[model samples]
Target: MDRIKIKSVTTLAEHWGALRQADVEYRAADGSLHHLKREIYDRGNAAAIALFDPARQTVLLVRQARFPALLNGDPAFMLEVCAGMLDGDDPFTCAHKEALEETGHAPRNVRKICNIYPSPGAVQEKVALFVGEYDAQTRQAQGGGLAHEGEDIELVELPLDEALGMIESGELTDAKTIILLQHLALERGA
Candidate 1:
């Protein structure tokens, strides 16, 4: 932990998230020193949750636009679990808030699925993942996400099997979504 010494950091951009480059001297395992420059996108952390219905073997998901995907030659619209930036709220609170905003169901039975860094090389953000149980009686609102935040979310409820198949079929590509789905699949022994 004390092997790396930071020399300086330069900000490249400062918008929704910060893009900065850090110069550092790293001490190798054999005691050799190496200089390195690393660029990181600091968007803060986020939380995502997969809402599942055990009785129906179904999961609640969302579809929305992702400009970054489009820019990277992938599908602009992504099918994913409900998620959002913490914005100062705790991970669990953020997950619940996103669930209510994007899926209409405030899950009562929620469990952590561990935190993950999908792009450790460039992104300085960690996501706290979760899975929650829901049912027909749990509908709190007609969720389509907040229009004011430019979020045009579409609710998609599909059988767990079908959702898992989407991963193999290349329809589900979001890392957080895939991780949560695979976790749920393993829990169900599917």
Candidate 2:
């Protein structure tokens, strides 16, 4: 607090998410004062889960439309692990709910993997990541995502090795999904 002084925070835009510009002064490493202005997007925190089936050696993921990615000249449809905003729920509960809603499988033995700020430079979103086991017995719904929420999701099941290969082929580009997959591989000593 002594090193950083926040001069003012002005809301630039407010809609589905908030955009604010912060004017601040910072003490540099050499004890020099530096003034800076930064714009931040606040969309709240979220949770994500990777569902792995040991018996089948497979992983469950979802594909959905992402306008931002399309705008960036990437594919509009992105393949990613199950994830959703916390919506005031705890991370663990959000993880489970997102899993069930997006993957059609309620995971068992859910375990926390890590927490990450995917885009800390501009967005104030901390995602809680988890890995959990799933099998035939866990299928509880069709899990196509909520249509009313403008989500049209496609469920995808891939062999672990194939999924890893997709990462190399540029097919799987979502950061959270890649992290969870690599974490699982590390856990398996692969």
Point out the worst 10-residue segment of candidate 1 by lDDT: 133-142
lDDT of 2 by residue, 55-172 (tens): 8989999999999999999999999999999999999999999999887888999999889999999998999999999999999999989888887899999998899999999999
What is the lDDT of every predicted structure here?
Answer: 0.94, 0.94
Residue pair clashes in candidate 2: none
As a whole number from 0 to 100, the lDDT of residue 128 in candidate 1 is 97
**RMSD versus native structure for model 2:** 0.9
Please report how far candidate 2 places residue 62 from its true position, in Å.
0.2
TM-score, every prediction: 0.97, 0.97
Residues 78-115, candidate 1: write the lDDT tens digits: 99999999999999999999999998898978999899
Worst 10 residues of 2 by lDDT: 144-153
TM-score, predicted candidate 2 vs. hidden true structure: 0.97
Off by over 4 Å in 1: none
The positional error of residue 153 in candidate 2, measured at the CA in angstroms, is 0.4
